[model samples]
Target: MADYLNNNAGMDWDDAIENDGQEFIILPEGDYNFTVTDFERGRFPGSAKMSPCNKATLTLQVKTEDGIASIRTDLILNRVVEFRISAFFRCIGQKKHGERLVMDWNKVVGSRGRAHFKPRTYTDRDGNERQANDVDRFYDYDEKNFPAEDDWMEITGDADDLPFN
Candidate 1:
């Protein structure tokens, strides 16, 4: 089993678990802080399924970037818990006739030169790190499906969690 802890001012809790049917921790719309620990578990089955926990710290901050739009979160991870991170975003609008939504890192800045990033890290029951490069390729959206400004952008990928701390 895995144990999660949230240590923030006024946060009177100590441990949590995402497995066994508990996946997410709900937080109200405001400025808050949290810490996740003892995530050292084996990966589970299924592509979209949750993996085992590794010793790490995940901090989420919800705030507006420029006062125009609300940037839901700023995730900061400490320690390389897993090889990948995945999430879904709400698609708000439709794409143009031939435009497509592609993961172009060049379009955005300050992403460590990672263009079209994808999740490609996995660990087995033996706790061995496995490299999964080809498995991280994007397949859903094509170049001809350009999304509108209001459309939601789903970003999924892997990163060197060691550098975060």
Candidate 2:
């Protein structure tokens, strides 16, 4: 194999991509159109606020002026997390008022609606103050009353034509 380390004669520290000191855009504190882009399972180490628990990481794509912003929310799988789960299902076009219904969580990936984002501030590892966006709640969006662009676009085409394929 060729020695790759010997080919960096013109390399400079200033030309390197800076991953640190990156700015995080905080969404304005308000309701915005959002979609459930992905889901993941994670574990939380023991903490003073609560015991270690399994959490469902729901990645949300919120519509913003610049395009879209990704925000993650961890829902601990415990008794206290029922309300959040229920609200999430309801936002995905599930009926809440009349009769009980079963929700297929797997099909919730393309669910879109209005999500309330709240501003949260915390100290970073370097003792620097940082701002983050938190999902407060989700609401059923009325397309008739307030029509907006659908965040998740459904592509009806051959699967083989996809770039990933």
Candidate 3:
């Protein structure tokens, strides 16, 4: 965080916050048992330049040989991408094949399943090469293959639980 601030001192403090040395695992490209830890509706830049759009953002916690790793995926809710949204629901044990879209997305949280990841390379604004483990696909989970709750990533803290100043 300090290094970033040093490199761009003109940047706004709000735009450049600290990572706080948080430890995270960058999972290798592969499939693993995962749980839906968080789900939310988020606004993101659309393909049309500055145009914004809403999407269902999912944070999956995958248990791997290294440790529990966090993987994020977005499902566009637009009519054109309904298939993607259905696929996401199927992976999370919600809707089945040929099933209509009629379920609470909130119920998706805490659901466990298999997630497939693939390594993708992209150039950042700084023209530096970076690699990301992106979700390639998701597999339906069998109850027998489910990991114990303890095996999944745990959220240790919440801002609401913190003492106020």
Candidate 4:
């Protein structure tokens, strides 16, 4: 495998690929490249403070000769304060295709923290209204009227994409 390191010694990654089996690979701290494949439109369930600005980029590549592939994701932890965040990709259909990347965050306040999700609303060009999805909820968080410092935040979803068989 090629050394997954950048010129600056930062860990580089691609997030758009997936392996056959379930496994986790720890990555060193650094900047990485990612692409957006699919995402879930609901609040990520966990102990990380989440903002509408939170987004994940996935990068994918495949080794034609060996049939090997490499993938990575960069989780930009851009919260107002220190907090814990957890995320994973859950496939929706039984065919084991179409995955939903779910993330959860818990706000860290001094010593205590609170669980929160993005506020949601719906609007139609012709005047129709509808409920927002998880992605929409995150977008709403990005667009703020008052624009509080804490309002605009982001986090990177960086991980190694392990390919199966």
TM-scores for all predictions: 0.17, 0.67, 0.70, 0.19
Off by over 4 Å in 2: 1-23, 46-51, 95-103, 141-165
Steric collisions counted per model: 11, 0, 0, 39
Alpha-carbon shift of residue 104 in model 3 (angstroms): 1.1
lDDT of 4 by residue, 79-131 (tens): 64212222222111111224332343221111111112222357888788643
lDDT of 1 at 104: 32
- Candidate with maximal lDDT: 3
Q: Write the per-residue lDDT of candidate 1 for residues 1-165, one digit (tens) a residue.
A: 022223222433775543364223323233221111112223233234433332222222111232211112221121231112211100112222334443232322211111122224589889998542221111232333432431223344556544564
Point out where model 4 deviates above 4 Å: 1-20, 44-165
As a whole number from 0 to 100, the lDDT of residue 163 in candidate 4 is 42
lDDT of each: 0.26, 0.71, 0.73, 0.28
State, as a TM-score between 0 and 1, how close model 1 is to the true structure.
0.17
Ranking by TM-score: 3, 2, 4, 1
Candidate 2 lDDT over residue span 1-165, tens digit each: 012235425756668663363245689899887777777778867577678887788888775676567788887766556677767776766657444666576776766767789989999999999888899887754565235654345577999989998
Provide the lowest-lDDT 10-residue window in model 2: 1-10
Model 3 segments more than 4 A misplaced: 1-20, 48-53, 147-150, 153-165
Model 4 has how many clashing residue pairs?
39
User: Model 3: per-residue lDDT, tens digit, 71-150?
Assistant: 78888767677777777778878878788978588698888777688877899999999876688887764566674555
